[model samples]
Target: MFLRAKVRKKDGKEHRYFSVVENRRIGPKQQKRMAQRTVLYLGEINDGQEAAWRKSLEVFDESCQRYSTLSLFPEDREIPAEASSSIQVKLSEMELRRPRMFGNCWLGCELWRQLGLQAFWEEKLSSQVQRETVPWEKVLRLLVVNRLIEPGSEFRLHRQWFDPTAMAELLETDFAVAEKDRLYRCLDRILEHKQALFVHLRQRWQDLFAAPFDVLLYDLTSTYIEGEGEQIPQARYGYSRDQRFDCKQVVIALVITPEGFPLAYEVMDGNTSDKTT
Candidate 1:
């Protein structure tokens, strides 16, 4: 199925027309021939007419279980109401299911590409030759995208968020990429490449935005854990930024350029002083 365009000369001027067309293979296989059938004649559409058509477009909101008109143009743009394409849907026969988030996940993937994290991780965390069920880099991408989009724990992403969102479709993999153990394993593997990952991101920022690193800003913050944190060596009693002094915490320090590009970060013992850091 495609759009077919035709041109005709009238009054010494070429006029253009468009129609929805479908290509069909006609006759037997031994004498096969291609034929185009016009499904709908669109005639000549002007800008105003097109805007009107777009203004009349509707989309189904599965979450709300309702339909709303879609706007192709910005909210400030005025659409002409002189023409419209109306569609009739039978409410009784219609069913809506499997509502997956798409826009934010797509944007997350695009940002990941723009930062060159895909290739960087692919090289850093190369897939093993043991016939891995899913690429380690892709799994890492899923984790990063989950953080960027919803900012949830790996457990939540694996149990609740993965199936409901479009990450599976966007990442081109099945539920294996979001498996609970795989997420944790991917994190464990990337710890060794932390410094290299920071360098790669810094270079990407410089290349993409010409970001300057001359003026570096440093800051430290502490995040307290709810439990005793006995198993974690770094977790200790510290100055609580969140006013949770009773709980064990870890101090996180970060260095960034003036333009807000992160240069480096460190996770120190909770008892470490800011001045010492």
Candidate 2:
């Protein structure tokens, strides 16, 4: 049992009220409190009047739960008409895919063939010896055919072979860690055949651009080489085109048509003067 009492002054008079709470549960079933409040004001406060006011309040609460249109409404309302959307959002179904390289399928194939890709691989590249070799096809496709891509990007595209499923799907080959070392060795073979490699590439460029060539523009530029230095004569330091004067540079001479179709290219000593040629 519990008791609560309150004293309040109205207009200049004081009045007192009391309430009691009785615990109704006797066993482990459950327990709850029943409460009733009494007051001394006979003029306004009575049991019947308070019961009527409470019933009205209860009806207002039910109406707000049932028929209220606007979210904020008067005290008499019951229900709210507005409800939020309960639709579940769907995820995108797109699969992981490679980027598109060329649009016209036949034209792309013709252009690749005109680049002497097949002959360069089977004839010239096959004729050379490698200290350790991987699929020569893979290396040639990367360095020779896809030479348009930067060297840093080559490793990214090449690493697709590191996944067994991706390797089987793309190349129809089961790749392993052992194959990666062989791939590196085959790429090294490209340096040994650089002269012939560039010569063949220059020939292909000439054939592709010969019909369209009129005015040719030539410029000399240099790129900084990374890692251990090679004994190549052309890899030296002078005026660094890439602004890497602190490091030895690889000088390249690029020849292009007025329209910007590349025709020929040559590498020479970085210290060589462009004005002399």
Candidate 3:
């Protein structure tokens, strides 16, 4: 069994929830074990109940309060320190209380806001053509860059940012829940525009490192998705890199220079041999 809890607080209210799910174990002992996850909804509680949950959560709250969250906030250009301190502290407290050490959407939004995305967002909104603004792109780019910097399951990506209302508010957008299909679509778009994406990345790299890319390295990866579709030029069955040949997958080549600058990428049928090039 697994337990899950959600806590929410809003309009001076608190709500608490607890749930459990069961799973089978296949380890050396091969026995069943209980898995528990909990979410607390502190937002629905009245003042009195809120106080009680706060009191009940005193240990965690204190851990948050005692943390020096000021250092975590980004330094904005020419902004008065006092002006941004409160927001920074609140964001820090939220981060400190998190159960894991992955990308925190609230923190990411706070940092992006401090980096002047808000002004860019407003500017783009006012444009006649409404061209894509640098800030919006930066935010998305940062999110993707973080993924490449530290790859993790899409579930983790969803869990870390998909449902955080405050984070959406900070980003001046809605928290459109990042479903797997949506994520795949976004990634596919990126792949379609891979050349332009690499050009932008290369420019940023040159500016940051004052160098150019050399000695491109290449490798391929495969992942089998659910369901069977007609094999395309880039889809086939082969040595399942994931050790599951029952399904067909596409092999995607990821190329990077010796200096770690990405050069190019391509996709082919899973049966396509990495040994080919």
**For this target, which candidate reaches the highest lDDT against the unseen true structure?**
1
Clashes of each: 0, 12, 33
User: TM-score, each model?
Assistant: 0.68, 0.46, 0.45
Q: What's the CA RMSD for each of the models?
A: 16.6, 23.7, 17.5
Give the C-alpha lDDT of model 2.
Answer: 0.52
Q: Each prediction's Cα lDDT score?
A: 0.81, 0.52, 0.52
Q: In candidate 3, what are the lDDT values of residues 1-277, reduced to their tens digit?
A: 2233467776889656543322434435566555432332223335575454443332212555662212223335243486553342233245434343335545655554554544443443344224432233434534553464456666666566445324344445444424444444444333444565566556655776666565567788887755685745556788788998888888888888777766567777778877894
Model 2, span 119-148: residue lDDT tens: 665565665535324456545453333344
TM-score of 1: 0.68
Q: Tens digit of lDDT per residue, candidate 1, span 1-277?
A: 3555688999999887876556779999899999987755889987676555444444556889997644322244444464365334443355769999999989999998889888888887775615688988889888888898889889999999999889888889899999999888887788889999898988898899989887899999888998888888999998999998899999999999888888889999999998897
lDDT ranking of the models: 1, 2, 3
Ranking by TM-score: 1, 2, 3
Which residue runs of candidate 2 sit more than 4 Å off their true CA positions?
A: 1-111, 128-134, 144-184, 187-210, 226-233
* TM-score preference between candidates 1 and 3, better one: 1
Error of 3 at 177 (Å): 6.7
